[model samples]
Target: MGRKRKTKIFMIMIAFVLFLAGCNFNSSESSNEETGGSEGETKQVLNISTTADIPTLDSTKAHDGIAFTVLNNVNEGLYRQDENNEPIEALVTEHKENEDKTVHTFTLRDSNWSNGDPVTAQDFEYAWKRVMKDASPYNFMFVTAGIKNSEAIMNEEMDTEDLGIKAIDEKTVEVTLEAANPLFQSLMTFPTFLPQNQKFVEEQGDQYALEAENVLFNGPFTLVDWTHEQGWKYEKNEDYWDADAVKLDAINAYVVKDPAAGINLYETNKVDRIVLSSEAVDQNKDDENFDTILEPEILFLRFNHNHPVLGNKNIRQAVNMAIDKKSLTDVILKNGSTPLDGIVPKGFFKSPAGEDFRDINGDFNTGTVEEAQKVWETGLKEAGVEEVNVSINIADSEDHKKVAEYIQAQLEDNLPGFKLNIKAVPFAQRLEIEKAIDYDLSLSSWGPDYSDPMTYLDMWLEGGSANRMDYSNAKLEELVASARTETDLEKRYQMLLDTEKILLEEDAAIAPLYQDGTAVLMRSKIKNLLVHPTGASFSYKWVTIEE
Candidate 1:
């Protein structure tokens, strides 16, 4: 969060256009408020809005931010990030690591799934195996790559049972890794590492996690209702091991794509918190309820290498440098977001020696606009094309369309004869489009899964599931592979730095537009609602709705 900027006239134009289009906007979700409570009483419930629909609640298949947000609330892993973003014991009492840091052992707390089944160490063992064994539709198995035999299991070269995680006893779980992973403990905080009740899963079969009744919760909340794309509701879990710490009785979330609609819900006192768009921010920065949230998220353009023009390195570099990111963020997105020139966002992580990584390896391809045009001309010639027709795919959200239109205009205006097409699809469809690599360029953003540089760097490995662009570089892969096992903090940091340079400066894998920052109108009465710089966006465990 930072000081607010003055509104630009162009920002108002964009908002006007959205309103003229007659975008659909819903009111809000109905809540369970006490009818006969005391005069000073208020219901411990939070009403929030999401920009997109959750694709899945299945831990092994969910990869989007929306799904992670819900799963983080309903599932407890071995560890969870506290208000300070520090790893704290959740399901486990404590964890011990060997000197080499390849082996980890965790002792379980006497927690229970919502179904009355005692949570056991075997639950984690089953979840890890499930992710690796079923790497179809989604390959979240890559998240557990560093674990011993995990890669082999993912490749189908070894049996899932051969994975190096074991339940020594009903209450003890042990994990072994192929190399020393500095971020192993931190990774446990991800939803992919959450435990699963095998019996419950098998019984539910294909219907598992598809609806509120299909999923079982072991975290601070339980899914009481789900209405698909509309929204969902979570009630505080009475069976949670730390249920006493959960202050909120219920939380309701709605999917509101139009920022204008979200603001309406907030104004009418139907929602407690609403994420504001740039236009909305300009209109409401003076409000005492407005708060800026700087995120460790980066918005970028993913180039599908399958495209004839995009496959050329020169073409990719030209596209990367041609755009004016400053104009995109300042003029198009007047929110707290800042233009970015690299994959990793600034202030996301620091070296063990305590220096900003962005400072260490400044901006890349940050040359003059004139230089960018020259390269673009040369790239067209190299690709043997007089003009290139490209399509940029993006989510159908109001903010996403605004940014996409800005990029489309920039490319067409700066690079002569460049024809751009914009494909705006629903959030769920956009994910499928990306997975299929069905477009030339994709507007995408990534939030860190854990507090490590590897979370971003490893996403583009040759055949990585997250590498929607299909970009690959032997040197970048080598550096990433080396860094994964390097116990020396300094050396590992250097390798990570080198990998970023290769991806951004040398290869131009993707065009990094800006670092995401959210402008929110949260009710002042809500207390202890924590947002982390990384991992999950909101934590409701200690949150209370006070009068």
Candidate 2:
């Protein structure tokens, strides 16, 4: 997930993967994880399924909130944007600001608790200070870094008060920003800034958050049951302040990725929705439930610049220009994955002139064994080396393995003296290995940060967390820093372009491949279900069932 910028958005995003009662994999019951059910009757359950198992629920430990909170309306932030992308109050009743934009205040909406108590501003205060104090790494803390002394507080230099949040009363809260962020209200729409009950969390200890009874939520739903391998389930939380608006009575989410099985479940009407493969699309294109969406997920190869051979631009570029993106898109991801040109995916940020990024005309000299060989030959000659043995790491999934296999064939064909080896591991495990730069080459995926160009462009900066490449460029770092503060949208975009140019076209530390829209097969009965631009899981809330 390239959600570094959306740290605030995903701070509250955690895990919740469930299985079924029949298969222990299809049950998707609610727990400490999962969401989505019918409105009036407890018998009406929406059995949903997915392809990947959630990683973990610890926000500080896991990036994606699997086993935690991909969906479920019980948790909420200060503000939330509606279908029109308009920012509106969620838990907060009103937002007040000073004339100078230096001070901000919020009035809570009398948000309720599962135990019938009023949700108060203290909840937000506790959650905020806790994350900063504990080094929660929820990314939301970073958004507040612009606040006075926030960075220092996160680094333990000052107390929580200096960190900039105050609960004046049971319903009132105040915050001071380092600078006026016009998007601040929209920023509050993220889960990171949401209120977490201090009373409830303190009582549970470490294990409290791992189950339903250990936590309290003020959202539209409540956690019912959760067990290992059995998917979580959720029912309506009638005590919520805005319970009347909630349409779903319960939501069943199953964590299984087998496309064939998922399709079968959908066919049997056991699943309300599922994700299909390119092959499945070909077969189900005519089915009524067949609806495909182009989502924000992008796939690419991250060079372990920490590796010996990866330090060279030539070798990196040879590998970068080698893979056939068109083949990957047209053949593998028939779900409309646009082949990338520069680091930023096409249409990451559109301009009056068109998209803000670059494209190599659907042909970046990738995919051809001959081109790879030529670049490799020159790279080897420049390094004064006759042979280079490299290992390419990939996720163990079938789709990922196919990608690795194709690239291996290309590398072997292009450079006879160079040996290409495959290092395959589970998706999450591969991420750990890649983070440590344990391989010469690794392929991975990233969704966006915000709806900004900086999300894709800033990752390659020196010392950036996402910069597993161990890549450093003085000029690149300068550009990234400047872009963050530029504020001028157009100028900021140009800064991103320059950064991408240096990282992809010039340094070649990373290879661009495909950007795709996620594909979803959903029950036509599922209405008001809006898949966010961020990714697939930021769903469940803001959705209603018609029947």
Which tens-of-lDDT digit does each residue in 1-547 have in candidate 1? 3334225434544653453233222222234343224556676778788888778889988887888878999999998888888888898887898998888899998989998999999999998888888874334433434788877776678899988899999999999988776667777787888889999999999999999899889999998877766677788898888888987777878777878778766886667899999889889999999988778999999999988888888777777788899888877787788988988888988998898888888898777767878888888898899899989999999999999988888889888878889999999899889988888999998988777787789888887788987789999988987887787899989999999999988888888999998898988988998887666777888998876
Model 2 per-residue lDDT tens digits across residues 1-547? 5678477434322222112443333342232123333354333356777545545443333454353354324566677656654556787777788987868998888667777767888888887777666655344434433455666674567886667888899989998887776556655655556677787777777875676676676776776665534455667777767777766667766655456666666765667888777678788777777776665667788877666566777787787776667777788767767777566666556743575455422224344567677777877887778888888888776567777887788667666677889988766677778777788888788776356666666666554456777888899878976876677877866777677777766677677778774466777767776555641234455566544
> Could you tell me how far off, in angstroms, the CA of residue 317 lies in candidate 1 after the best superposition?
1.5
- Give the count of colliding residue pairs in each prediction: 0, 39
Best candidate according to TM-score: 1
Residue 159 miss distance in model 2 (angstroms): 5.9
Off by over 4 Å in 2: 1-19, 22-44, 59-62, 65-72, 115-117, 137-141, 152-161, 212-214, 352-369, 381-390, 417-424
